[model samples]
Target: MGHGWRTLRRKILTPNVSATYLETRGFRRKDRESQELLEKVGALFLAGYAHAVEASSIADVEARLGTIEHRFRGFAYEGAGMGYGMLDGLPFGHRHHNDDFLAGPAADQIYIVYCGIGWAMARLPRFRWPKAESLDPLLRWLVLDGYGFHQAYFHTRRYVHEHYQAPRFPWPDDESRAYANRAIDQGIGRALWFVGCTDVAEVARLVRTYPAARHGDLWAGVGLASTYACGASRDELVRLTELAGEHRPQLAQGSAFAAEARVKAGLWIPETDSATKILCGQDAETAARISVEMRPEHVRNGALPSYELWRQRIAEELMSLGGVSK
Candidate 1:
């Protein structure tokens, strides 16, 4: 498409910047610093999205995203991934944008990219959704994670407050369909971090409101968000570990996954370092190693997908460490 048309497309597709404000979303505003930090994250994401939609090539998008600060660069790539995914889902646009981007600039940020595709899924019609089989078998679940985050972030009343779950998600036709809600819940758990403004007590209360059976996955989500997003303080992270209680193993697993994601993308920051140390009882590299070592080789070997098995193994590994403690 021409530059003019692409600019117009970007303008039409991107949400207003204010949509991300906690106040605008009716989400909790714990304090000025926390709200500003989270809002900046949203701004970076939108900026990345705009770059992707308007760029002429993958190189063009990369050039723009490269300018983002090291700490927030991964999120920019994530937003770019969403832009590409959204374009691919459009009826008249190129169909291979997401694949090409993933093959090129997004190779290291694969986890964040897949989750970004889930963000696209939230915006597109069901028919326009990508085939689940097209994604890596072990990582496709991250797309649902992205979707869950989007739902809980934007539709808080339904997905968070009302405890709404997608009844029979239709994408990715497979036996794993039954486990879809759990994956999405993991995303919801992640969203709770933002929803509660990284308030450990509030986030814990929100999780507690859900049924007991769902707490494990939910706590895992919190761990991932807390570690990856880096909003909670050391004391708050300690409280999070304390609040996690029996689900500490799952929480640690999530922290490890977050460590893996940030380290793999070369986007490790001080906040991630602190969060991992507090939540996973290990340094970032060690936590990341645990995640890698525990990853399952076969995607379809068991009743659960390799993704869940990977998470389970990581949780088991952390549990052996006697779980994270204040």
Candidate 2:
């Protein structure tokens, strides 16, 4: 059984460079039911992809993508397994083996993976949604080869990407097509809001505005409140968005709607990595903020660092070899 588990791990860890091979691999499930569920969702993804391909125009493809989005949203928000409602509601942010931390009923990890995929897929063809048929291969790739990758990615990559490279858009971008792609590549407008840089007064105001019991989606609010952290006036905020459109085309196109979504939700706004850097060097406030904001008590209390911790651990190791302490 140990050897079998090792084999399973190997298969999962193997690189998935080929789309064809990805189409045929079986899932690693502890039960018959999970295997069946996997198959069902895989079919749904494929059908949606095919529909997007068959659609007549960009609008039609978007409509089909909308159907896929709606279905995935149902899975994300309402499905019995691994939905956003279930994951976001956990108070402690701790995953229990008996409680479905990485797998099983509370598939928060998987649901997040799917949501990220859906978000990106619907915005292909250089961040433009692809024709329906072109999407099939991508969907198939996701279900077969991409599943484990996403599982690991959410646990680790999501934070860095969110902070360093990724931004969630509530809807489509408005910029000219050419500019949007480059901006995303250069890492514009992607920062997680709650990483401890917020002013205490602001935190207090927000907590008072939202009772602790309802702060489960607090990160969403962080994005909305960001410019305030920068002390940007309303006009400045609008100017920043315009600057993003003019200079960082990718960010302007893709993130405007997402920023608006956060704004509408009464959430705080995103503070870029540069803003974070301002808070990171030589001050107690910066250290405290990094410790508290990027990692809360639940995360800091763990025996093993989460995925992000491990990455940092490796960097620390290399730094030590170079006789530098970061």
Q: Rate the local accuracy (lDDT) of all candidates.
A: 0.89, 0.28
lDDT of 1 by residue, 98-187 (tens): 899989989999999998899999999999998988998889999999999999999999999999986788867877887888889999
- Show model 1 residue runs off by greater than 4 Å: 323-326
Separate clash counts for every candidate: 0, 24
Record all residue pairs in model 1 with backbone atoms less than 3 Å apart, i.e. clashing. Answer: none
TM-score of 2: 0.22
Question: Which 10 residues in a row give candidate 1 its minimum summed lDDT?
Answer: 296-305
Candidate 1 differs from the real structure by a C-alpha RMSD in angstroms, to one decimal, of: 1.3
Candidate 2 lDDT, 127-165, residue by residue in tens? 333222322221212221122223222222332223222
Per-residue lDDT, model 2, residue 52, is 25
